[model samples]
Target: MDTSGFLEWLKASLSSSEKTSDRRILRFVHPDDDKRFLRSLRAERPGSKPLRGIRRLGIIRAYSCPVPPEGLPVSFGGAIVWEEDIRVSTHAILAAQRVPADSGIPWGVRRIRAPEAWSRTTGHRVRVGVIDTGVDFDHPDLRHSLERGINLLQRTALPHDDNGHGTHIAGTIAAANRMQGMIGVAPRSAIYPIKAFDYNGTAYVSDIILGIDWCVRNRMDVVNMSFGMSTRSKSLLNAVSNAYRSGVLIVASSGNDGKRGRIDYPAKYPQTVAVGAINRKGEIASFTNRSDSVDIYAPGERVDSCWLRGNRKTMSGTSMATSHVTGAVALLLAHKPGLTPEQVKTVLKRSKRPLRNAKAPRKTGELDIARMLQVADKLM
Candidate 1:
């Protein structure tokens, strides 16, 4: 049967059941079947009302619907209904202390030796997509670094920071108000903030998948994902894989569960460059998820960056650490645009500085931008 037939059958099968109001259904169709799939959704059956709140994510060739809670096959007519899950921001708000404009660069940026690599490339022309809460466009440090971004929650609105997490993350990646405020690792890089999460820093897995789709379609060079969830979602994995295959480097947080060997989804996925956190003393953070899956570490403790309402706040987590790595990746991509995600990860791993304390510290270490750039230079 065609896609519309399958959708019609599925709708009929679910509508006959009693519990159809509480659950959401995400249908994944191949790109070639998108038009037919959407047409089926638009066509009204004789007795049923049109499907409401249908979200179409064309980049991923998927659409989400509200369905009943009943046993349904995983796949139908070449479409897969993904399991529903929630993803949260991986950072912890330490405090809301404001810093002086002359506070200089944040310690995290300086510790990574980003300044040393500035002479060669300061992430000029690199587009970094931040899939998080949104950004504070009015923030002085980030005013000029932001590019037009999409709001998945409200399609017609701009992706403005409401939770402050994206603003901080963006500041770490490319804030450039050097004189009026602090500088980020890649001050010249443009940030495209994709607001998938709400003010509470929570987002559905489908929204995140849509965010990654936006990144790939928009030609973002690097994607900074600071949120994570323990449960694995195949749809999320497929989205990450698709973005990586499209030559977009994905940098994600290793989660802040303090678990020794467990990393979060998307980060746990091998296609992404997973990052962990370190403190000022260069020791592995107590809250960071440490494991072989973690590709590298960076300063994440008590880190300061731009916040909502044009302010600065101190936060901590693998999310902050991930931002540092995201900026570093932007710097590398700025210098060498053709570098693949694997090549970028390899260079980052090779240039890591040894951790002051951790088991098997040599296996993975902190990011060293100066050394990373040097390693990239050797490839030229």
Candidate 2:
């Protein structure tokens, strides 16, 4: 939108108070008003004038909405979504690769590739929702970074990490351990655990939709979905679509069935970035499912991290890989303020760690951290 026209629209909205009588148009606003946009809510009714600073910028060509911006995707094709600001929190992206182990509950911090950039920034205040098996609040790797959570599956008052999958996924993306263990992709990031699966690895589509709806309503910068299914659900896709329109990033596992191109529900739905499994050796795990929807690969086979029952163990599947990408997306959100879910996907794909061969059996490449932070805005 033109600068003059945008200003004019804001002035008119403040006076009339409506974007349109029937719709809430969500798109990017200028830097000066982004913060205010988040803190302030539009009071105008559907048919009122419009909200101030809200512009009909049309489709943001800079970022791919995964699915197109008009309405929702045909088969979860795409949705119109936009992000407000960058949440740069340097404390959130630290890792634990080389840290020394503790005697009993010790965990080391894995150093991120670009410490210099983070050194100059405190990191963004990015809040990512972890929709998985639930997380343990006491895990050494995830203690301080833990924030709020919900249990959509059990409908409990508090959502705890029971299945261990959510905790590992949480640790990978936002665990903030300054003295020990590993730091996540966005170490300083806050985690909102929304448990949708039980310890038995079962969940209902209704619960998953609730989880996605919560993330969207709560304004989560990214949602870590470590589960997938073969059958498609209207509720699931609609929830995802609602989230996209609300500017929530959906990252899901590519499924662990290990079958060649076994179709997964939400992951296969074009609305999400489906992550595949990769071993420490950078090889795709044999059990990892392959599909045209697989967006990227990450450490999955026996990938070591926090586990269920307060245990630290190795687990496999695209579930682990999704956490890696989730963490990475959190980092980008922290530094690249104002990135749409689509733009974040764009940068990550561009920065991907190339596979050994483009024509190899596993075309998807490994996680690329260095290239991701190359264009981040300094938080400090």
Candidate 1 Cα errors over 4 Å, as ranges: 9-35, 42-50, 71-81, 85-87, 358-360
- Model 2 clashes, total count: 38
Clashes of 1: 2
Taking all chains together, the TM-score of candidate 2 against the true structure is 0.67
lDDT of 1 by residue, 92-145 (tens): 546567766666699999999999889999999999999999999888889999
lDDT per residue (tens digit) for residues 243-267 in model 2? 7777888998877667786647688
Would you give me the overall lDDT of model 2? 0.60
What CA root-mean-square deviation does each model show from the true structure?
A: 3.0, 13.1
Best by lDDT: 1
